[model samples]
Target: MEYTKLTLGIALLVAFAWILFRNSKRSGVLHALIRIDTIVGMIAGLYLVITAVHSLFF
Candidate 1:
């Protein structure tokens, strides 16, 4: 598995989520979805970062 690509992709997802969050402040449901997406993306990004670091130094 390419942690680099996954991390980069998650970064893109977070960026996209940021854009969506800003643009969808007028809606309730969309905000909920965006929040879920952001949380998932952040968790995945954290896992990837930890795995990458472990692979590098362990």
Candidate 2:
């Protein structure tokens, strides 16, 4: 479970970076991809934080 969560987080982080770095170079499909990636990254960050805290405290 932990490994899965970490992998997901890493994937999202990479997606987020790609979206961010590519924004000025492309649009249309790339823009859509960026939006999706940003949302997924936010969710993954939240999940990772929550899980980490839960594990630390409980």
Candidate 3:
């Protein structure tokens, strides 16, 4: 379960980075992808922080 979460987090991070650096042209699809990527990145970041805090305390 932990490894699965870690893998997903890494994959999301890579996808977010790819989307971020891919292009500057803003098409509709690009805009949507950027939004999705941003959300995924935020979720991944929050998951990591929560996991860290949980581990540290309990």
Candidate 4:
């Protein structure tokens, strides 16, 4: 389960990087991808932290 979560976060970052970097025509996509990764990474990191805390408590 933890491995899956790790993979998800890594995969999303990789995908976003690929898409954003590939778009050589516009810088808008750069900002968009940054926003996306920021939000998603935060959520995923929060989830992991919560899971770790929960496991410790329970």
Candidate 5:
């Protein structure tokens, strides 16, 4: 479970980074969607990190 969480977190972080890089060439609604995607990815990644750490130590 912890490994799964860590893997998900890494995936989300990578996806967020990819979106950020990809957004540079996009515009309008597509750009907006990318922004939303990036935010969601970041939040999910952070949550996973926090949960993984908590589970590991507590």
Candidate 6:
């Protein structure tokens, strides 16, 4: 996939994961969901940054 596509995909995935994590915490389904959100968000941010850098530098 192209860098833009990858970046957007990552962002959407991260958002979805975060929403799930937040909702899961309400019912006390899994305490680890928050961690998942954090990790996914970090990965998404990394992807976005990398894409931006590549677009600018390359």
**Clashing residue pairs in candidate 4 (N, C-alpha, C atoms within 3 angstroms):** none
Q: Model 2 misses residue 15 by how many Å?
A: 0.8
Tens-digit lDDT track of model 6 for 1-58? 4567556756776776677667667766465554576567667766776777677678
Q: What tens-digit string does per-residue lDDT give for candidate 2 at 1-58?
A: 7656656666666766677666735665556555765767767766775675566567
RMSD vs true structure, all candidates? 4.1, 4.3, 4.6, 5.1, 3.3, 4.7
Q: TM-score order of candidates, best first?
A: 5, 2, 1, 3, 6, 4
Which order, best to worst by lDDT? 5, 6, 2, 1, 3, 4
lDDT of the candidates, in the order given: 0.65, 0.66, 0.62, 0.59, 0.79, 0.66
Q: In model 6, how many backbone clashes occur?
A: 0
RMSD of 6: 4.7
Among the numbered candidates, top lDDT falls to 5
Residue 57 local lDDT, model 5 = 87
Q: Taking the tens digit of each residue's C-alpha lDDT, what string does model 5 give over 1-58?
A: 9979988987888888777666765665456565776788889998997898789889
Between candidates 1 and 5, the one scoring higher on TM-score is 5
Top candidate on TM-score is 5
Candidate 1 segments exceeding 4 Å error: 1-34
Q: Candidate 6 — what's its lDDT? A: 0.66
- TM per candidate comes to 0.49, 0.49, 0.48, 0.44, 0.68, 0.45
State, as a TM-score between 0 and 1, how close model 6 is to the true structure: 0.45
lDDT of 4 by residue, 1-58 (tens): 6566556656665665565566534666556556665557556665665665565567
Q: After superposition, how far is residue 29 of candidate 3 from its true place, in Å?
A: 18
